[model samples]
Target: MNKLRLLVDSVWRLTWESREAAHCEELFVPFNPWRESDLCMPSLAGYLENAEPGSSFKLNLSPGKYLPQYQTDKKYEFALESFASGTRPPHVGRFYPKYLLMGYFGNPTPFRCIDRQGGKFTADFNHPLAGRFLTLEVMVREIKQKRDEKGGECLDWLDILTSGPGIEARYQGLPTDFFEDDPFHREDEGDDRAFFAQPRLVSHVDTQAQAIMAALYSRLLKPGLAVLDLMSSWQSHLPHGLELGSLVGLGMNAAELQHNPQLTSHLIHDLNTDPDLPFADGQFDAVICNLSVEYLVRPFEVFAEAARVLRPGGLFIHTFSHRWFPPKVVKIWTELHEFERIGLVLEYFLRSGAFGNLKTFSSRGWPRPRADRYYPRMRFADPVYAVWGEKLA
Candidate 1:
């Protein structure tokens, strides 16, 4: 019997939202294509039979293979106790446990909440991937012989990737209500300058996650583009040896920006204090904000300013993970589903009206580097989420 290890990249869609990419890597996959028809889907076995270490291939899973295409029904709608902020009620386009809505054992599957009225909240029981076409890019991490031909569980990588409340879902079937209280409000109403006064030279995400973010930047950032690293800290996660025309860091802490090795020049400017960028229009080819977008109180103003600074065809990219300081992040950000957070950022681009070709990405289930401090506690690396679009000119 053969055993395989794979990282599955699933490109899924939601109406009007950009395509969502989810990457899941598995340590062990039993490979008896004929006997394990249930391993992935029937269509996946053919690819596994020939897969090998370091090989990657893409395939399309027919619609309805996930759950069924979304169906219109009454069971989805339910009433809410109240819309109070303290109660933490469910809102539209987020997910909740199946049991939470129905009052019984949910078996751990998450259901998308599609709507919330004055008193009721509707839950979409359909798999978030339902009706959405699934395009998978599989990379065979390792393939080896199972020393013994013994029975084992058929761990579906797709389920592991998309399962539980971990996955983010559709932006909204209808207009989503933010909340009764202000979402832009943060736990600490103190001036941001005061909060960021001290230079915290620590990595927000783990080292492996940092490498992934830099890899992402390397792909989107052309070699000679003038890139702006907005709200940057001590370290700009640009690839080690990239040649750029100029790298500018704009942030609150002067010392932090000054310490970033990637920045050609750095400025201590708080977008919260002054939403406008201090640059001529069309000056930069691209702008990037990393791990710090959630803290922006004036995101719309900042986005408009970013667009104004970018050249006609320039790109604006924002990458973030699930970590944030509770007292500093915008209140709504804390409430967003990890994927819905992508939609939240995507909205920033759409509202700009200056960008197109928008897309979102999420990578999960990668092995955490053993060297990282959290490696002992967390199984996989911290999931990385990014949203980006290019200016229309």
Candidate 2:
């Protein structure tokens, strides 16, 4: 199986094993829309910031474990446990479902004090972050890379540590185009549904392009860091058998993404429409944008957002191919030829002014033989190109 799917399966098992036996009680995990909600969920620790005023989801929980219980219905209940906040007195007298909506519900279960102790009680079936706006800072802790117990090799785990803010390195005043003609920046002109109409699970680039992607992942991706596959498709083309904390995919089509077992979880979004990412800043150790840079019109704005969200010294990698549909490709790209596309992506990063220590690399392969007799959409040669930049503090 792919790395992302493997991680999800392993994590799901671990979550199950960790919280299998406990007194079951109804719990609230608020779905916070604002605050540090851009980072990927299911990986972040703790209950997230509270949801908006009317948003709430239910989970049946057992004590000492985070995953909610979904099996049998057993009743051996005790009295209610009124929540007490640190540095604040017990508010049992004023405890209403509405108060929880307005107040900061810290890890109410872990290290929380109760008015009447020693008895297990089900608090009101209210959401934890009912009325309050929470400011949550995300941190990715240990990513386990499990290996075989024997002398044989096994999955390697990567424990990501937050070493303060990311490193800040300055660029050496490189002359770059603040605005370049993008070859693939056209707005969808046809019917609204037609724009996102087809779920093309096909890889835009040929085998050469895919091989380059695998090699790139192998060389740049460490064994245990959380990896974000931005502008992702059905296939991440990540190298096989690599250990990763999490391999999250962010793409537009649900069906295409669902088929990808590698994605532990995926967010369906169109960057062309919504430039702001739904992830917390510095949430991932690395972000991979593969074969999709050509389609971005607001490249700088997107890059800036990526830089803002990335940890200092976090890596942002982009790979592109000299292939695109004429109608879908931007005016600029249609105007330029193949080799210049690489120059264009570099200009994109430089123009963003958010990336430091930018570097470029080329994969060596025989260019596809150009077809003398051509059908309209059939191309003869495959193009390969890639570029990378590091986020500065």
Candidate 3:
């Protein structure tokens, strides 16, 4: 069954486990001792033993007022007494999805129900689902194999250790800077590691700027081309219905890449430190870097790397917007005016000596009112521009 159902079912069974099991009575004093004589106790301890802890844990025995006494170290005893009371009051327990059940396989560590409110409730010191009984709503079974007297290495593990060869090596001439320079860079060697280690999964552009990006992508990208998504994140946001042979994502965060449904294969690498891509020469038909050029301190090396990996006649297109984290964006990007910034990017592509035809596109800012209707005092700015080039043979 799904993990959510497993968690919820565990909590449901706890109400019965605490009441019927003889063990729970051993822990706490029951409020209504007289009722125990009329009930049948069942073996629910085994069920509780396997129950996964829920996201929120609370005991509402007999659905009355909240009992603050259960908040103490003697909570197990209180829970047992409440269970025996069998009042079955409106109850609430920590059983929800989107929770991490933290525990070890062989330990007596406390199981905690952590909620969004930032409160961690430690339960009966047993598994949170320990005081419950379970009914199997569904059963899962797999085919079993009959075994012979002698057991040899399993075929799966053996095959993993003896997989066949993949692509053969062919030497493509490396760029001059490939062997001469180091591309891997760290902003500050002595400062907090978080400065560069953390991945900020956010859009680099505003909504209007994103529309501009999508428009540029739509115009430049076509069907049946192998595309490289450079500096990708949790979202690629490529224009819809564009059929491409391949879409390879290259980024820094593995978790981000793993969940990106659009990527065929993702490589986790920090380009600032090493511009050398883990790809072959002329491997992609097109390369797209969206809203990331401002962050590149070593733009020349990265641009060259992009050109090296792109096939002849392939396109290297990058779009930029007005927004950027000031500190993180290189000084050059932060200080430049619009025309200068475009020229700067254009120079990077031209200087790389790997691109053939270079071009630029600029989308003026949000539509302005007619000059005669304008208010006396205001200046607005265009927020986006894109520069691109074709890889040379």
Work out the TM-score per prediction: 0.84, 0.51, 0.47
Q: What is the TM-score (0 to 1) of candidate 2? A: 0.51
Q: What is the model-wide C-alpha lDDT for candidate 3? A: 0.49
Give per-residue CA lDDT, model 1, range 1-393, as digits (tens).
Answer: 333333322222212222432323222233454345466665566667666567766666556765566566723666685222346678666665665544645455566666667888766677665655556565665555544445555555656555432244334333345544687898898988899999888889888789888888888887888988899888888899999999999888888887788899988888887998999999999999999999998888999999999998898988898889989999889876676677678767776778887766676666678988887798678888888888886
Model 2 alpha-carbon miss at residue 366, Å: 2.3
The model with the greatest TM-score is: 1
Q: Is candidate 2 or 3 superior in TM-score?
A: 2
lDDT of 2 at 322: 66
For residues 1-393, could you state the per-residue lDDT of candidate 3 as single tens digits?
A: 222112111111112222111111101111111222123122222222233333222333321121122233533212222221332211122221111222223442322222122222323332332222322111112212232224232222111211110000001111111112222233433332245457666555544456556766888888888999998876776776777889999986777777777788888777777878889999999998877787776788999999889999999987776676555566555433443355456657757888866666554424322352332242232256667888888
lDDT of 3 at 327: 52
Q: Which ranges in model 2 have alpha carbons more than 4 Å from their true place?
A: 1-187, 190-193, 364-381
Q: Best to worst by lDDT, what's the order?
A: 1, 2, 3
lDDT of 2 by residue, 33-145 (tens): 23223443443412323222232223322432332332223212233333333322322211222233224354322111113245443333322212212222222222223
